[model samples]
Target: MTEGRKLRPEERILWGKVAKSTRALRARQDEVAEYEAEITAMLAAEEAALARPAPPQDVVSPPGNQLRAPRPAPSHQPLEKPVHRKLAKGRLSIEARIDLHGLFQDEAHDLLLDFLFRAHERGMRHVLVITGKGSSMGSEGVLRRTVPLWFSKPEFRFLISSYEWAARHHGGEGALYVRLSRPRRSL
Candidate 1:
């Protein structure tokens, strides 16, 4: 037959090869789709595993074999005794003051610690700590109220033997009367 009319034996063999290739391609596509579904299922399972909540349990335990019973907390006890220091009957004549207006918290802390240490070393018994009464801005000043808090800290607590508000004759409310510990020789 002519080119378009009918396929010869050789042409029929070529058509059969083409048909086989198409069937193979369809089979490969089906296999690919099945593999994709399996991968998606595995991913979903992994995500579900991740979303599972951790078991609720206590991380902390009581000391040794002692079982801790739940009980009301004890009232906070105020430390009445002086920390690591003792005051003398006599007072030193030395008085040093610092104006803590523009000082940052850390800088002010360091400066105050250094001042107290040096004063104690120099045998200073009575000290005037001048924290500018407070700010007119209503923010309770810079170092005004915080200095007292620092004095209560364990580290700085020992440095100061005893302290009270300064007399009205002195800077009064703006300053504190810090009575540092006397040197061993002075004692």
Candidate 2:
């Protein structure tokens, strides 16, 4: 530990090598400590998991099989399917007329429904619809064509059995002939 001392070349080299080895050993020790700390943390986490309760898992079941609690019966009977026609041909068993003149969309919808219900109730075979030639309204008949689109929606579909452009004598392009399902007479 002299403050100033001349060293042999070989001695200086040996001392340098020894210092390098010592630094490498210290680095290895640090790595080993880090690995040990990681393992210890992992073990603590496992122990914590073991101390907690496990959540319940649903039972595995095959397709179409599920475990469920019993439910009470419905208060009312399910509705029977209303009888309807499957074909479109001459003269519907019931008919309805709709006039779109100045009615707004919803207004026209309510009117159409009313006409259908009345026609069905009365057992009328076929009816006519006079939407009025839309040309006069500056629409070039856009709404007139749209009426059929509305009729084709699922809600209104069940009411109509078939439809066609009205006969020339009946109003032609300005009107339609709608056929509806006749109400079933329950014995």
lDDT of 1 by residue, 50-86 (tens): 4564455544665786665544322223222342122
CA deviation > 4 Å runs, candidate 2: 1-96, 185-187
- Count of residue pairs whose backbone atoms collide, per candidate: 0, 7
Residue pair clashes in candidate 1: none
The candidate that wins on lDDT is 1
RMSD of 1: 31.5
TM-score attained by model 1: 0.46
Tens digits of lDDT, candidate 2, 8-100: 656655765676565336759889788879977975875566456455555666678876744422122111223122112333332445677
